[model samples]
Target: MPSEGEPHILAEIAERHARIGREQLALLRAIGRLDPEAPWVREGARDLPHLLAMRLGVSEWKARRWVAAARRLPELPGVAEALASGALSLDKVVELTRFATPRDEAGLIRWARHVSVWAIRRRGDLLERAPVREDRRAQRDRRAEWWFLQEERRFGLLAHLPAAEGAALAAAIERWAERVPAVPDEDGELPDLAARRADALVAMAQASLAAEDRADRPTVVVHTRLEPSGGPTPGAELERGPVLHPETARRLSCDARVQVVLEDGHGNALRVSPVRRFPPEWMLRQLRYRDRGCVFPGCGTTAFTVAHHLRHWSRGGPTELDNLALLCSFHHRLVHEDGWRLRRDGDVFAWLRPDGRPYRPGPPPPAPAGPPRPAPADRPRPALAAAAQARCAPGPAP
Candidate 1:
């Protein structure tokens, strides 16, 4: 970037790319028109946004935004001209026209040359509600609520509350937070208001959970498998989520009911007199103990796992432990639907990518701090120079 003559070249390249973007937007506008005109009907897409999303490999919201921007572009000659001349970007055009009127477009476009998207958004009273008339469906789809995941524990919550509900939650949080005096932390300082409110929320949730009986909770399904390969010990699987570490699955198994099925050497189901709908409780327990959890690598989920057959049952695979492995629902689907394969070794499942190459995980992280290994014993302390001292004291150089 600091090289001489680079400025001119970079600017020219940027201009060319921007011009290309302008032309691309124009073409996108043409495609946008066909969307409402039902051009994708034969393509089996449910609607224009669906078609665009599939074709562009983008989210529905993004596809809708681009389509809407394209539909509005014809009416925005000034925006079109500036875009064509590369004076502004498609993003700037979208934000500008999100609220600006034809009379204001010229000045806004000129002003936009100097400001950021957020700055332009803050400049409008109409921008907030402009899309209501232009595209009521898209505007209505946007929710006021928020959702977030706490990744450390793989817990997440989604909230799609309306204005009233949001306000109620806000008020309750504030009230509960104010009810308790801030406890002194290690630094002898009280937590801030936000932290206090967060704590109150957790307390509220715990109180609610405490009101319910544990027996009323739903059952968790865990799958366990022993790998034939000399990998890590057997692992746990969740049917719909990640795999669980073996230790975690074992800990959970202590309190949960279990059912297990055995696959024979071939991977076919063995017939029992009653057709044994579920595996024997004892067998399930043993499976859990042996495999620990889902054996699929890196899944990190312990509950709701399903036992899988390394060889498909329809293909005449046996119905005993040798042919069975534990898998989460997602990876299980990959095998059944996406052509990915998991070959079982002694204790490890060597995963294979759909393209037929082995799927190796990245390098393992460093081990945590633990007891240090023992070293050789220290030598006994040397005898104090007794002999030399004795010789010197005697004044005779022996």
Candidate 2:
């Protein structure tokens, strides 16, 4: 079926790909020759992987693989020769380097040429020898981190787990993903499997949070300015996280259990108020009974909803039923962080944008409303109460 020139074109493509592999081998040799300590130190990187990631604009994961392979190449001359001569692809070489020693590199090189990159990688994984020391190292290396890209206003997560635990977690996510319904785009095409997995992760988190007793839920504390300064307020800072935009702080405060810490301009604490950060269980039940779900014009999510204070508690607002509403996380952010506002006229609420235009004309008919089904009877609370008391017990003076 091939045209006369098709075979020639395909051969040329294969040759070019082989040339890329040779170039990669040269790069690895160059990396191996660099004084590993001096460059990373001068570049302010913790290790070769960090430096490579920053300089090459590669992912930390990829940088790590490259660094490991480069370190092994000098000892495995056969692998280096195969890659440099374009007999072995870079991907196959990288996987081989993971388990290859001087004695085994030649055999792996020959076997790798006949197999796919994934097969070689799987072989390397199975070849790994797990001794006690390696097990200890695995435990030591287990870590998870959250990194923020300030320019993109996004966060990235990286996690390294021991093989067994990682496999279990992956299985859980895959199973959850299977249960997640596919969401169609504007063109009616469903999201990809990866996106569905992300949705599954979020759903898992929601379920976990919902299972916790109200009194045992985690609290996030955001330190922010209530007093107006001469200039525009920059943003609110989290006690344990990065600085948050002002609007973000507002959105978080909507439903979060928060403590009010009053401080003077000089950063000296004036007082720490003991006001309840969130409504008591009884009050929350009343709120659910009243608002039913998110009060936003069209959003009616009932699960994982939070109580929003129409008049923020920090601004001398009372915590009475008249001042509270139920909102899901998304619409809550829309109001606090995204420049949307709500106006209450009797029992109805109106949505307004940052530019003061209405989201919909007048009061849209009330969102479909109903209280959540009654929960089971409460469990004994002594252990939880004790834990709370100990947690609130002031830490020893710094």
Candidate that scores best on lDDT:
2
Model 2, TM vs. native: 0.47
Ten residues in sequence with the least summed lDDT for candidate 2: 389-398
Candidates' lDDT values, in order?
0.55, 0.68
Worst ten-residue run, lDDT, model 1? 389-398
lDDT for each residue of candidate 2 in 125-170, tens digit (9 for 90 to 100): 7988878897786776666655457899976666778878888989
Using Cα atoms with residue i matched to residue i, what is each candidate's TM-score against the true structure?
Answer: 0.41, 0.47
Model 2: which residue pairs collide? Answer: 258-277
